[model samples]
Target: MDYFSQSIKQAIRTVPDWPKPGVTFRDITTVLQNKTAFRKLIDAFVHRYHDQHIDAIAAVDARGFIIGSALAYELNASLVLIRKKGKLPFDTLVEDYELEYGTASVELHKDALKPGDKVVLVDDLIATGGTMLAASRLIRRIGAEIVEVAAMIDLPDLGGSDKLRAEGLTVYTVCSFEGE
Candidate 1:
């Protein structure tokens, strides 16, 4: 990994057997707690997307909102939130995806996007790629185009990023962990 990537990797905390046995969870709370590292994390994304004509940022529920909002503000783009089915109050478009364990669905407000709006999907990490894939479908259902999917960390060994790339998406992550 390069210097910045290494920095990001160093800032992350790894917890073994989290949420389930044999599952190593990479946590970003460390990065969020460190001001310099947080800035570095956001700057890495802003630097690459500042010049890109990205109309909006559609972040996955929760953590994605954290980075996505900051990025949208910096890039002068709008923000779209892809949330859990009942979390949204307005009419929504829903998309279902398979998780490593089971299934889940995400929703986007129906009026969130205009036809042909260019969007970048954001999240804290890419694991099984199901959430991002569901978010992508939610965007497409609203007639918006996804420019790419961006995340802070990627568990490449889990094959999430590879699955997204196989579907023709450009996936960007500051750093990646080899094993899950």
Candidate 2:
């Protein structure tokens, strides 16, 4: 990894057996707490997309909102939220995906994007790829083209990036934990 990526990775805290046994959660709150780390994290993304013609950033719910809002402002692009089912107040399009134990859904407002809009999907991490895939589907359903999927971290052992690539989506991450 590059210098900025290495520093950002170091700022992340790994919580073992989080929410359940055998699950190591890669928490980003630490990075956000460190001003320098946070700036590097955002700058890494801004530098990559500044030259690209990006219309909007379609971010996955909750965590994705954090990175998405900053990136949208930096790139001069609109921010579109792909939220948890029923969280959106408008007419929405929903996509359901499988989780480890059950299925969950994400929703995008009907008018969030127009046809031919170029969007970058943002999330804090890629684990199983379910949420990102669902969000990408919602973007396509609205006739917007996903320019790429961006994340701060990737747990490649979980195969999320591979799953997204299998569906023909480009995946970008600042750093990856290979066997976590």
**Which candidate achieves the best lDDT against the true structure?**
2
* Winning candidate number (TM-score): 2
Per residue, candidate 1 scores C-alpha lDDT tens digits across 58-155 of: 99999999999999999999999999889999899888898667888999999999989999999999988999988988888788888999999998
The reply for model 1, stretches above 4 Å from the true place, is: none
The TM-score values for the models, in the order shown, are 0.96, 0.98
lDDT of 2 by residue, 1-180 (tens): 899999999999999999789888898999999999999999999999999999999888899999999999999999999999999998999999999899999999999999999999999999989999999999998899999999999999999999999999999999999975
lDDT of each: 0.91, 0.95
Model 1 collision count: 0
Task: Show how many residue pairs clash in every candidate, following the order shown.
Answer: 0, 0
Candidate 1 has its poorest 10 consecutive residues by lDDT at 171-180
lDDT of candidate 2 at residue 84, scale 0 to 100 = 95
